[model samples]
Target: DYHLLGGGDSKEVYVGWNHVQQIEIAWNQIVYYEDDEKLFTEEATLLKSLNHERIIKCCHYWFDSESKILNTITELFSSGSLKKYIHNGVGVDLVSIKNWGRQILQGLCFLHSQSPKIIHRDIKCDNVFVASDGKQFGLAVCIMDGDFVKEKEPKCTPEFMAPMCLLEMVTGEYPYMKCSNQMHIFKKVYTGVKPVSLGNVKDYRVRDIIEKCILPMSVRPSAEELLKDPFFLYNGRSSTFETCAPVDNILTSRAMNIKHLYLV
Candidate 1:
């Protein structure tokens, strides 16, 4: 049996424990209230076809006719989502951040390079997961259904959305939010008005990368192109680790301390 981990939209996530191997696994269950069988089938097919180190692995899947529920078992990452990690204030070094950005871009490149090409409409920190050792990252969930792809309008968070997507949403459309409608947001984005938070970023390299990602869709660089950017060329080794004492000294320090006792 699996314990409920968390849930979102119409899906529930569970953590399963294997007594024999003493390991844990993650199961994503999507419950259908309506008779949308095609959606479930397509999602399953897409998940099964995807295989990448930076994308969560879907090992097995099954459907329960009685409950109208679809379940998929995938690898369980211990650190959970990247959004939570950043909010917790652990303070990741620049090297690790660059590595993470590179990994994410690699995953995106793989998806976009496919025959039909998969556009992850919802690419945000919340959907990115971290491994137990914190050395790896993976994209958690995606919407691969035909409706989202053909609709042309993006269904994603406003903050992470590119200006092109925002324009599409407000084109010949009325306001959605009261205080700030889609048009207002689109105007700000289209006119080159950046978010206040962006100015707070001290690193020009990081800021430039972020700016490139939000450019008009017509000019926005593809994932493969961005992978070759100079920003990702920085060696991921931290100066702090490089300046650490030699491995032999670190391993033999305790033995050397006890040597004086024996000599006395």
Candidate 2:
């Protein structure tokens, strides 16, 4: 029997066991809005085409004509999402960071290596799953991600949501927390001004990589190129967990210095 897992604005997730396959699966039931049917269909098609170890596998999907729901069955991860770990106070040392970062880049490399080159617009901690080995190792699986929506007015919510959510949810503040609204976020991003969270990263190598990721798409390094970066090659490890300040503390300390400069 299917049981509720979680849900969002337009979709509800459920967990169920496939009797024939003898495996648990995540059931993503999306409500297909008539106005955005094409977009939904495109997303479904893209999901179907993806198959990689680093990527979450969508075993099957079907549209229910009567209910107007698009149902997709994907392999389930018992360990839940990466977001859970971050929120639960898991100590993220340099070694863990390198391994996780490399795995994420590997998933991105696979998507980018495709003929048309797919871009996962939304690469947040929530969308990334973790498969734990019951000890110290976890494998990351990136779902076909990105939530960029286009309309008459440029919407900056989804564009900034990933970084904002990752930091704000865990630390109670994000880089541009001083910004009052989406328009302010838009201006900050447009001017190539990065969030202060990047500077808070303890390791220089990791910080540099994070900065590179936010560079303009024209100059941003491809996932394949990022995979070869020295951070992954270097074997040296450090105890970042103990030294790094809690995200909230770091942001709060800088709060007085950060001005909500809205130049419009």
Candidate 3:
């Protein structure tokens, strides 16, 4: 019901790609069916006012008191969510996942940077959509399911829960002692120091930012904070995202040169 409007329930996506040109979403929850239509119209109108690449752009909306229905439309993405792709024997690889992680952060950064600010509380693989060519290897994660997103105090998910969650759960003391929800986890992670339980992502850049994003706020990382992140580096026959690929010999040369330079 909620997902289809703009981002229909995760299960509803792809039910009928051709049936609708754009999906509508409500800015707030609808407790009454009578108000559902109006909610979609109003929220869609608001979202349409903003612009960003990763966000599923809202198109238009209208109120139909006669039919007791509200209408809103948005860009139609034929490709489905990353969750859908993962369900069909295509688990996101390290490279693609890293790119996705980067893009998700980018989208969040864009929203959080807004004058008022917007936060996608439910950030997960299922909520993220892929382009129609989602299978095309190299596209970053596309954020969808904005209906559940909020501009103020946000709702947070437990899974994909940031590290501070684990830390607070484990340590359970001041600072994070009262922490709850995943965003708190992210806030703690933004500090730069690693949260105890997390492991490293394969991509150096991604891993670094994840650590940065989760870094405690005292040392928060910004979107402009650049690391040596690779876009698409290839070596031999297999791409980096590929499961099997040859290692580059040049790394040894570079390492040796650095060693000599340091010694001097």
Candidate 4:
């Protein structure tokens, strides 16, 4: 067995490559495309199309017959997944997390705005990769497993799940009943400890967006909804997403009662 260096998800390992004889269907796909289907090929091509300092690049892909597995040969790096970094005595540095979050959101916005929105369905720390070096200045993580899809019988993770998603699993649970505010989220992240405290928050617009993202009672924003705002923009250049959150116009009147949860 070869010891591959890497990080993992439910379908992958902490580090390394797995060989398969053919393509294993993505666990979350509603159904695999027919033999002549081009969805997978199309996505691979799209991944190849995007390149940015903060985006995770798709290195290569191949299918094996004997083992029945398809593989993506990615650019190997010394840094691991964001989860590892957080676990190894790494506190979430606000600025770094902000940069990483902005890049990812920009990627997501691009994906969602496409003909058919590509729901990351699964987004969390582990699915994000850390930059190879410290000098990158930005946390520079990218959307890993970008080509993944759901199966007829899909499985999901709970930890990073939007609560409404928890309900979709047929495990009836109560949704959050209150309107969430920014401080409410700080409490969750702080988790019983003193608040990390914000400094010069107005100076970091990228951060304000992320803080909006992790709010416990907050609902996930749609690419369309973001576009409706004069703030969030697709300027066609720059790494960080642009925003002007007219505080009154930015935060939507959704979440807490999270309506639609699962994509599949």
Candidate 5:
């Protein structure tokens, strides 16, 4: 049986067994609008065609014409989203954070490298999933029908939006969290002010990455370029077992010592 995972305005996520193997899927029940159907179909097709290690895998999809419901089967990350992972205060060392950032950037690079160039307009912590093995998985919400154009004023969570989308408005509040309204948030975004979260980040490299992502549309670094940044590099050495063994042993010994002290 499929158990409820969570839901948003458009769809619900569920976890269940795929015959013998356990799997998770997202199910969207279309309201039967012709345009909505077309858009959903297109998104399904696009998702199926996309295959990348950092991007969520869409295994299959089925549409029930009679019920007007669309079902999409995707890989389930039991560890949940990055936002939740951080909030839980689990495995959040600098190394893990950097690894997650690199993976996310790689996923973005793949999408942007596509022939038509898919822009993940909504890039936020909540949209990034974490696997048990500490890998990051990005959720892509495709923007259809020229929504990126200025006239449409695409709807997005202000906190995660790029500054160009907000017309360079600067704000002291974190993106979207402090704004009284969308227009207020828009003005703040237009002024090119850094979000409160970015301002509070103590790590220069992490802060730099966030700044690059929210730069004015014309000058923002592409995901490909961001991948090449020194922040992702690790002392020009492979992170192989031989290189990490000594450090790992030290850490393990320290942990054991702490445990023994506590027991005593």
Candidate 6:
């Protein structure tokens, strides 16, 4: 039986078994304008074509004319979102951080290498999920709200942290969560002011990476370049996940949580 899962904006999610496919899938049901249904379905098609391991797989989709709803069937990620681990009050070690960072960067690389290039306007821990296999994949991607704009602009969750979401991973908190409002964060970002949480990142390498990521767009490293950085090159083994901490013990099936971004 399908069970209600958390959702954001006009979308709702449910997890249940697909009898025909004989698999568990996360169903994303999004409400769209009747006239704009084509646009939404096209976005779903794009998702279905993606084959990267770090990107969520959209099995198929269908639109209900009378209900003005678009339903997308995707592989279920039972471990939940990265946001859950960060705020779970459990400590995460550097090895876990590095792996997550590298995976996300890989996902970005694949998306950007597309014919016309695809940019996930929204990249936050909430949109990144950990699969049962222990790899994190990007979700709530591409047409986040079923709307596309020719001119690129900042369209992310109001609480989105721009430094590849690495800062939040390191500090275990969201950047600018202290800011009074969205405008306040925009003003700071426009003026090149970083969240004070940047100081909380103890590792110099992690701090340096975050700083470089937050630099002016002109000087920021491409996903490929970032992956080649020294931080991810190290081969040191860590016992963090080997010990199976509460953060790594994600065995139970959980519903996918999707948070919609507010268009800027």
lDDT of 4: 0.37
Q: What is the C-alpha lDDT of each candidate?
A: 0.57, 0.57, 0.39, 0.37, 0.53, 0.68
Model 3 stretches with alpha carbons more than 4 Å out = 1-42, 64-70, 135-154, 158-207, 226-264
lDDT, candidate 5, 67-110, per-residue tens: 66677777777887665555453434446555666777788778
lDDT of 1 by residue, 16-104 (tens): 97666687888777665446566666666677788999988787787787887777888888797665555444544557657777888
Q: What TM-score, over all chains together, does every model reach?
A: 0.74, 0.77, 0.50, 0.47, 0.74, 0.84
Q: Looking at model 4, which ten-residue stretch has the lowest summed lDDT?
A: 250-259
Candidate 4 or 3, higher lDDT: 3
Error of 3 at 259 (Å): 51
> Model 3: per-residue lDDT, tens digit, 160-180?
334221112112111232357
Model 1: per-residue Cα lDDT at residue 223: 75
Ranking by lDDT: 6, 2, 1, 5, 3, 4
The TM-score measured for candidate 5 stands at 0.74
Two-way lDDT contest, 2 vs 6, winner = 6
lDDT of 2 by residue, 1-264 (tens): 889987656567799999998988888777664554555566666666778878888778877867767788888877776656565577666676667667777776786676555545445555567776522322222222223334332322333423233233223234565678767777787788878655556556666666676777678676688778897766476655432333432110000000111111
Between candidates 1 and 2, name the one with more favorable TM-score: 2
Off by over 4 Å in 5: 20-32, 136-152, 163-176, 235-264
lDDT computed for candidate 2: 0.57
Instruction: Give the lDDT of residue 236 in candidate 4.
Output: 28
Count of backbone collisions within predicted model 1: 0
What's the true lDDT of residue 209 in model 1? 77
| Clash count of each predicted structure | 0, 1, 15, 20, 11, 0
What local lDDT score does residue 256 receive in model 4, on the 0 to 100 scale? 11
Best by TM-score: 6
Residue 229 shift from truth in candidate 4, angstroms: 9.9
What is the alpha-carbon lDDT of model 5 when measured against the actual structure? 0.53
Decide which is better by TM-score, 3 or 6. Answer: 6
Give the candidates in order of TM-score, highest first. 6, 2, 1, 5, 3, 4
